[model samples]
Target chain A: MNGSTSSQKHPLDGLLRTDRIPHIWCPGCGIGTVFSSSLIAIRSTGAEPMKTAVVSGIGCTGRGAGYVNLDSYHTTHGRAIPFATGMKLANPELSVVVFSGDGDLFAIGGNHFIHAARRNMDLTVICVNNLNYGMTGGQAAATTPYLAKTSTTPLGNPEAPFNLPLLAYACGATYIARWTMLHTRDLTQSITEALTRTGFSFIEVLAPCPTGYGRKNKLKASDLLKVYQEKAIVKNGANPAETILDLEQGITLGKFVEYDRPTFAQNYKAVTSD
Target chain B: MEPAVLTGEHFLNGDVACAEGALAAGCRFFAGYPITPATEIAEHMSKRLPQVGGVFIQMEDEISAMAAILGASCAGAKSMTATSGPGFSLMMENIGLGITMETPCVLVNVQRAGPSTGLPTLGAQGDMMQARWGSHGHYEIIALAPASPQEIFYQTITAFNLSETYRLPVLIMADEIVGHLSERVIIPDSSKIKLRSRPRPKGRKDRFLPYRPGANGVAPMAHAGEGYMVHFTGLTHDEKGYPVMTAEAQAEMVDRITGKIRKNLDRIIQVERYRLEDAEVALISYGISTRSSLAAVDEAREQGIKAGLLRLLTVWPFPEDMVRELAKRVKGLITVELNLGQIHLEVQRCAEGRAPVVLVGHAGGSVITPEEIVEKIKEQVG
Candidate 1:
C-alpha cells in the first residue's frame, strides 16, 4: 500500500457529508459522477457554498440533497422545482439548484418544470436522465427511450421519449445543455456556466442506471458508457428541436441554448419598488 | 401600498382580515392559487407582501403552493397559503412534508362544500376533520376555527405564532360563510400584537442538528444561507437531519411531530365557554356554527332551558379534557356544524357515555339555523 496519512482526504470531503458516503448508487451508475460534477461546478462558480441550496424530489437522484453539505431540502415527489422556487423568491440571497431525476423532474413534476421555466425564475435545474425510474427498480419513465425494456414495460416501451432540450427551449428556459456522465469536464463546465446564470437554467445529464435500466435492456455498464462515448456529438448552437436521445441515432450534446431575460425576482422588484 | 399593519377599526371580510392578520404576524411570504372565497386572501397578499418588502407568488397549483410556503418557511420567512376544499385536498401531500420536516408555516383553508368541488361559493365546516387528518399520517396538528371576520383576523396571527412555536403547519379553518361575510374588524396597533418566531440555532454553526428538539419538542430553525448548512427531508431522519430508515427513527420523529402539541395542549387548545358556568345542557360548535350556537344559547336561555355554548377557538387538539369535564356536568351535549356529524363524532368520543351527544348537522349548502340547535338543546334539557 502506498504510504498515506490517515488525515489525508478527498477534495470533495469539504463539500459532502462524507459520513453519508458509501452512497446508494449502484456500481457503474452515472449519478455519482453527475452529482460530483454538479458539486465541482458549484465550487467553480466561486459562489459561497453556504449561500447555495439544493432541492430534490423523490427518487434515487433525489437523495442528492441528503448528501450535499449545504442548506438542502429533500422534498416530496415532483416538487423540487416549486420548493426551490419558494426558497429563491422568499430569500433572493440564496442560490437555488434543483437536482432530481427524469421521472421526478419530467413525469410527476412536469407541470412545475414548465411553469418555472415559463416564468423565467432564477434557478439552476440539473436533471439526471437515467432514462427510467431507477428508484422503483427500473420502471418506464417519461424519458425512457422508445422500444427500451423496463420493469413496467417488459415488452419494450411504446411511447417516444421527450427531447428535453426542446422541451426546455419551448418552456422559455434561458440556459439549456445536455451531456453524458462520460463527458465529466464538459458537464462540469456547462453546470458552472448555469450556476452563474440568472434565469431558469436547465442541464440534462445522461446517466446510466446500471442495475435498474442496464440489466433489463441486456446492456452491461461498459456497453452504456461505450454507447455514450461513441454516439454523443457535441453540437453547440444546434437547434434544440433536433437534439434527441436515441442510442441508434447520434445523441446531440453540448450547450443548445443560452440567452438573457428578466428573471422573476427582477421583474417583481422593478414593478414593486417604483 | 397599505402599511403592513393597518392599526384601526375597519369593516373587512373574513378573507381580507385573515390576510391582514398574516402581515401583522410577521409573515413575509405568501404563495397560493386562486380559489373561491379564499381568492381575496391571495389577492390582498400579492399587493401587500411587496409593499412590506415580502414576497408573494401565485404558484401553479395547490400542491406547489403548499410546497412553496414550506420552502419559504425553511428560508426563515413566515409564509402562508389560502385554498378551498378542492385545493386543500390537493395540498395534502406537501402538508405531510411540512409535518415530517417540522417546518413552520400557516395554511388558511377558507372552506367551501366538497367531497370534490361540491359547492364553490357556499360555506361549509365539512373540512374540520379533514383539517386534522387531511394529510396521511398519525401526527397531530394545530387548527383554529374562527367564528367571525374579527376572530379570523386574530386567529390568522395566532396560527402563525403557533406554527412558529411548534415548528409545524397551523391551520386557520374558516368556512365560506366567515370568509365572505363582511364585519367590523378592529386591527390592533403593531406593538400591541404578539409575534413568535421559531427558535434559532446558537453557538456553533458547524454540526448543527436541524431536528434536535430545543424546548417543547421543537427544534431551532436555521434558515438557508445562514451558514448552518442544514439538511431537511420528508423521509424519517435522525437529529442530524440525515435520513435514517429505521423504525426507531420513525418513532422518534413522529413522536416529536405529535408530542410537541400533545404535551403542550394547555397552551395550544383554546375554547370560549359562554354561560357554561351553571348550564345543565351545552351546545358544542366551531367556526360559523359557533355563531348559530351562540344565538341558540340565548334563545334557549329565554325559553327556560339552561343551555350554554362551547365555541371552539382551537379545534385540532380538541379541548378533550374540558369536554370530558363538561360532559359529566351537563345533562347532554348538542354538536352543531355545517357538515353531517364531523365534530359531533369527536364530542361523542370525548363525552365517553357521560352525556348523550347529538348532532344538529346538515349536508352543508346553507348554515344550520339556531332554531334547530335550540330544539336539540330543549330535547337534551327535557
Candidate 2:
C-alpha cells in the first residue's frame, strides 16, 4: 500500500462512489471527462445531494449513474428519460437528471425522447454522443455521421445522422446546447445551466470512443480532440436548423435554445389542484 | 380531501373496480398506455387519481408506462399500470427491470386474446404462461386471477399488498370478460381495509445497504431522496446495490429474490374451494374459467357425480402442494381454462401421474362455458 495514497483524495470524492472506481471505461475514452464535468456541475450547483437523482439507460456512459453518489437508477435500455420524468413528477422537490449515450437516447429509446421533450417535462438530459455504440463494440448508431466507418458499417454509414439540436428544439426542449468533451469548461457550464433550468433541458456532448469508434475511423484519441479544437465553431444562439456537424464543413458548438414555458409538473398541478 | 375508499355499494365493471382498488390501496402514481379491455382502468384512474392527490400519466407506449411506474415507486410512491395483450408484451422488458431492482409496483394485464392482435375486444386467459415467463431471465413473480368484478376489486388491493411485502412487481391477470362485465362491488371503509407497505431501512443511514435482506429475506427499501443516496440497477447486484458480474453474485441475487416468496408460499398463495370437502372429482380453474367451474361443479353434483371446484385466486407461486394432495384424493383432475393447456401443464406436473389430468381448453376469443366444463368433468369421471 502506498502511504501517499491514503493522505491524498480526489476532489470529487464526496460526490462519487470511490470504492467502485477503476471504472469500466477504457483508456482514452472521453466518457470519463464528460462524467467528471457533470459531477462538477452538479456539485457547483449546490443542489441538495439527497434530493437529486441520476437516471441512465444502458450504454458505456450510462455507467455514470452508478458512479454518482446520489439517489441514482441505472434503468433498462432507452428508458432513462421516462424514468427521470416519473421521478420528477412523482416528487416535484426531487431534481432528476438523465445521463446516457447517443444510441440509448436516439435508437431504441428515440420515441421516449421525443415525447418527454414534447411534454416539456422538468428534466436535465445530458446525451454523450460518441457517434457509435461503444458498449457493443462500435456498431452504427442513430447519430453516426454519414459515410463514417463503424464495426457495422465497414464500408461507410448509409444513413444520415440526426441533428440533435434541431430535434430538441422542434420537440419543445426549453434549453438546448452542444459541446465536446474537450471543451470541459463550456460543457460544464452548459450542464449547470440545464440542471438549474425548468422544463426539458438537453445537452449533446461529442466524445471520443477510442476503442469502439476511433480505430474504425482511423482517428486516435488525441486526433479526435484536435478535430474538435480545430473544427468546432462557437456560435451561440445559432438557429438549430443551421447548426451543422459535417467534419468537412465544421462542428457548431454553444447554447442554441434557451427559454422557459410551464413544465409538465406545473401544468399538472394547475389542472389537478382545485 | 377525497376519501381513499368509497365505502358503499356501486355497480362497476372489473376494469373500473380495479382502478378504485388501486386508489384505495394507496397507489398514488399510475402510468399507462391505452389498450383494449384494460383501457377503462386507465380512464378511471385519470379521473380519480387527481381527486385523491395521486398522479396519473398516459405514457407514449407500454414500455415507457412500465418504466415510469418503476421510477415513481422508487420515489416513495405506490405506483401501478394497466394494459392488455400487445401492451403487456411491450411492458415485459421493464417488468424484468422492476423485478431485479426489487421495486414494488402493480401491473394489471386485463388479458385479451392474441399472439398478435388475435381479438382485441374479446376475452381470453391465454396469457397465463406469458405472465409467468414473459420477461427474459429467471425470476419468480406473483400473479392473481379474479373471477368476478367484486373479486378483482379485493384482489387488486391484495396484489398491491403482496407487491409491497415481497418488494417485487405483482400482476393482476384479469381477462377481458371479467374486465368488461358489470357487477356489484362492495368497497369497505378505510378502517376495514388492510394495507401493507414495504419495510423501510432502519439503523444507521451511513452504513445502509439498500439490498441487504432482513430476517424475512426481503431487503428494506429506502426510497429516493431519503438521504441514503442508494443506487439501484437492473443488473445482478450486491447487497450495496452495485452491479457484481460473477456467477456467485448472480446465484446469490436470484436465490434471495425467488426464496422470499418460496419460503412463504402459504401466505402468498390463495385458493377458494367450493364443495371440495367430499368430492371424488376436482375441477381446477382460475379467472373467468373459475366462474364456469363453479357452475359445472354444482351441475355435476346434481347428476350424482361427486365434483368439486378449486379456484386459484393467486395463480403464480402456483399451489403445487395443494395440487399434489388433491391429486391423491381425487379420481381425476379436470383443468379448465381459455388457453390451450397452459396452467394445465402445471397441474399435470404437480399431480405427478397420481391421477389422470384432463384439460378443457379453448382456442381464445371466448370464455369456456359451464356446459363445456361439465362435459369434460363427466368424461373425466367416466
Candidate 3:
C-alpha cells in the first residue's frame, strides 16, 4: 500500500454499513459525519432496518437516502418532511427519518418543515447545517453566519442566519435539539433520544465543511471544529421565548426546547375519531 | 363461474363514478385539494377509501398532492390524485419526475380553461397538449378522455391498468362538462374485473431492472423495501437506472419512455368509430364535446349530408394512423371540440392533405350546441 493510503479513514463499518460507503459526498465534506451519527443513533435505538424508512431531499446530503442500506427515498429538495409524514401516516408502525441539508430543508422547503413540526407527526427530521450551500460550491445560505464570504456573498454577507432549533420550537415542535459534528457521541445521543421521543422531533447538526465554506473563508475543517468547541453553549432556557443564541461568538448547541401539548395529528385524531 | 355479480345503481355525476372507478381499481390512497368540478372525485374518494381500508389526505397544495401519491405508490399501494387546471400546473414538475423514474400512478385532470385561468367551474379541453408536453424534457404518457359517466367508470380502470402496465403516469382527460353532467352508471362486481398487478421477477432475485421494457413496453414493478437496489432519477438513466449524463444514454432513455407508447400503439390507443365506412364526411371529437358531435352527426344524417362522427376515447397516443385510414375513404373531416382547436389539429395531421379538415369549437366553459355543429356541417355540404 502507498504512504498516501496509510492514514486511517474513519471506517463506517458494521455501524455505517461499509457496503454502501465510498459515499457520493465530496472529499472533506461534513455531511458524511452527520450521516454516520444518524446511523449510530438509528442503531442505538434498535429500530428494525426493514421497518424504518429514510426520506431525503435534493442536495449533497439528499444522496444519504441512496447511500444507506434501508428503505430510502431520494426526493425533491425541501420536501422530505411532507413525504415522510405521508409515509408515517400510511403505516404508523414504521419509523420515518428525514435527512437533508439546510437549503433542501430551509430554503425550498421551509413551509413543509414548520407544518410537519406543528403536526408533531411522530417523524424525526435531522437537518445538517454546513453554514453554506455545499453541493453547488461554497455559496452563502440562510444558515450562513453574518460576514462570512460565499459565492453569492462575495465581499461580506449582510443577512443573519436562521437559528433552526429556535425556529422549530416556535413552530410547535415537541422535541428540538442542536449538536455539532465536533461532539460526535453527543450528537448521536441527541439523535437517538429525538428518534424515540414519540412526537415531532427536530435535531440540527452543525458540521464543518473545510472544502466549500471553509476553504473560501480560509478556515480549515479541524480549525472550524475547534472554534465550535470553544464557543458552543447548550441552550437550556425554561421558556422557549427566553431561548438565547450567541451571534458574534458561535451558535448554541443542545436540547434548546421541549414542551408537551396536544400535537397536530394526535389532537386531530381525538376529534376526528369516533 | 362469474363470482358474485353484484351491481350498484347510480344517477351520479361522472366525477362520482370516477371515484368508484378508482376504488374498483384497488386504489386506496387519495391525496388532493378541493377544486371545482373535480371536488366530487375527491369527496367520493374520501368516503370510499376509508370504508375499504384505504387512506385519504387533503395535501397543503398540488405539489404535496403529487409527492404524497408518489410516496404511497412506493410503499406498495395504488394511489391517485385529482385536480383542475391550476393544481395540474403545480403537479407538472413531480409528474415529470414520475415519468422519468417510471413510477406507476394515475393523475385525473378534470380540465378547465386556461392560458391562465379562463374559467373555474367551466369546461375546457385545453390541457390535452399540456398533458403530453407540459413537463420539461421528453417522456410518454397514457391519457384517456371520457365522453360520459359510464366511460368515466370504465376508463379510470383503464387508466390504472395503463399506469401499472406501462409504469408511467396515466391521465384521465375529463372535461368539466363530462365531470358535472349526471348520468346512469352500473358498477359491476370487483372480482369479475381483471385487475393487473405488475409482474414480479419471480425465482430471479436482484436481477430486476425496474425500468426494463417488457414485450408490451411495460416492465415489472418491485415496490420500495422489497430488497431491490432500485435507483430512481429524473435525469437520463440506463437499464439499471443509474443516471448517466451522456448523449447516448439520453437517446436510449428517451426512446425507452416514448417507444413503449409508440411501439405498442395498438394497446395504448383506444378510439370508438361511428359510421366510419359509408359516410362521405367524418366529424371527429373527444371528451364531453364528443356528445355534441354525436348529436350533430345524427341531425346532419337526417338532413341527408352523409356525415358521421368519430369519437376519441384514448386522447394521448394520438390516433393519427386511424385518421389517415378513415380520411382515405372519406371526402373530408370536420373536427369539433369544446376548446378553440386542440384536437382539430390532430385530426388535420391524420387527414394528411388528402382531405381538407375544418374546425367547429368554442372556448369551452359552455358547450357548443348540436345545432351549431350541424350548421358547420351543412355549410361544408353546400
Better by lDDT, candidate 3 or 1: 1
Per-prediction fnat: 0.81, 0.76, 0.19
- Identify the runs in model 1 with alpha carbons over 4 angstroms from their true place: A1-3, A6-8
Candidate 2 global lDDT: 0.93
lDDT of 1 by residue, B274-321 (tens): 999999999889999988899999999899899998999998989999
| lDDT tens per residue, model 1, A18-129 | 9998899899899999999999998999989999999999999999998999999999999999999999988898999999999999999999999999999999999999
Candidate 1 chain A weakest lDDT stretch, 10 residues: A1-10
Candidate 2 lDDT over residue span A38-73, tens digit each = 999999899888988999999999999999999999
Clash pairs detected, candidate 3: none
Backbone clashes for every candidate come to: 0, 0, 0
Model 3: CA > 4 A from native: A1-21, A236-247, A258-273, B1-6, B204-208
Candidate 3: tens digits of C-alpha lDDT, residues B230-283: 656565777766556799999988888888788988877888888666888898
Candidate with better TM-score, 2 vs 3:
2
Name the top lDDT candidate. Answer: 2
Instruction: Give each model's whole-structure lDDT.
Output: 0.92, 0.93, 0.79
